[model samples]
Target: MPDARGSSGRPRRGDRKLSGDRAGAALKVLQITDLHLRDDARPLIGVNTEATLIEVLDQAFASFTPDVVLATGDIAHDATLPTYLRFLQIIEQYHHGPKLCVPGNHDLIGPMIAARLPIDPLRVGNWVFVGLDSHVDDEVGSQVSDRDIAELVAACPPIGEKRHTLVATHHPPLEVNCPWLDKDRIQNASDLLESLARQTTVKGLVFGHAHQAVEGQSNGIGLFGTPSTCFQFEPESERFAIGDEQPGYRWLHLYDDGRIDSAVERVACSFEIDLTQRD
Candidate 1:
């Protein structure tokens, strides 16, 4: 790893802020996905979605200061207008930076659009973040149209000049190995992949909907799936079941040189869950 030391051979000021300096010069990013927020009276699989979202945000506020915040999707549980507004209000409480978003199967796009929530390609600290809505009608599966793909490609700047690119979506572009969950994986991932292939600057793909923390790669591009702020799903299971994990979020430190450091932070609280009831 190149040292964070100045050309004079002395350690830089922010060098002491990070441990060992492997992070180099990077953007500290906080990502909270799959909020699944609903009314105060309603709960998703025995967990109060709205309350848990607050808990997760509260924790992130104390621990991280992201140059950008990505709310990947499923922001609304009931797909109601109020839920979307509430989600926006809660997010605005702490995050003042770029808030990028994409819609999941449970999200109602029209209402979100009308509310003026963030959903644009954001450029920050030499990196461009592109959001793709994978919400497909009548099917839990998502599709990326050729037009969507073209827009994503067109929005990307020259790889070396722009630093890097990160693509955000609501659906996992590849199978997660959980049979039940895999069925809802992006049905037209080929469109996404083909689009990504055209943009060589892409360094990361962050998504939600699996409701679990997952890390892997697709054709050497870094792939990440974040856990929900509400609950989690068991990974690699044949059937749908609630995971034992508590509410959590993922954080990323994106370096200007196309290198990224990421991790999953499990919340300090564990609420009672009725695992027998499947979502």
Candidate 2:
């Protein structure tokens, strides 16, 4: 629909490189979400999510070589280990750098535990990536546990000369103003914001679950929500429905002097939408 390319066409060249003792290295971070991959080998919501993600990754690698990848969540359609393993295999093939993931509602926590996926908060380059588990057991809505809050609190770096922190989760901590999706948003979000408000190093929060691209600000921190790699949800809709928007991913550019800029790029794919299924 609208221009999926988030860039303004004018690339600014500064004296920052990906290495060395700068305020922070210039980082190209890719954010993709709402894959909803299933083990049944059938397309979800009339689109092949796994295939789309693979194509997206290929395009990303060819066009932009990112320093890190942040898969916000909804990596699987169901909580099956096969889905996770398959998704992991696809990621390993394309990405050679550090990749971080958070769990969505569809993820199986027990299987994730068994797989021994890294759950600790991590720091890469000049950015601190904090992964949180917000999936409630057998529930649609999300919540931040006491332990999750503690980990986020502990992950905060000291004020000056600290890495810019980006909190990654499956659910958005702020209301998206959509009826059906908002009902399933992260509960107790104010508490998380309260904890984040006190940290100067915490730069922003990025999430995926709404199946749409959204950007906003809260408590002076930037908030970004990525679109689904397979399908897009109608934005600001009162009911569940698919939008005509293209499937895409977000690319973030972190400058050396504590400046972060990001844009969404549409995937190169052709697919027909079946709107009748929404009824």
Question: If scored against the real structure, what TM-score would every candidate get?
Answer: 0.87, 0.85
Q: Model 2 — which ten-residue stretch has the worst lDDT? A: 9-18
All candidates' lDDT scores? 0.77, 0.73
Q: Residue 134's C-alpha lDDT in candidate 1?
A: 86
- Shift in Å, residue 220, candidate 2: 2.0
The candidate that wins on TM-score is 1
lDDT of 1 by residue, 18-122 (tens): 345454477887778888787556666778877888888888779867788998888877777787888888888888778898889888888888878899889
| Clashing residue pairs in candidate 1 (N, C-alpha, C atoms within 3 angstroms) | none
Clashes in predicted model 2? 0
Quick one: best lDDT, which candidate?
1
In model 2, what is the error at residue 76, expressed in angstroms?
A: 0.6
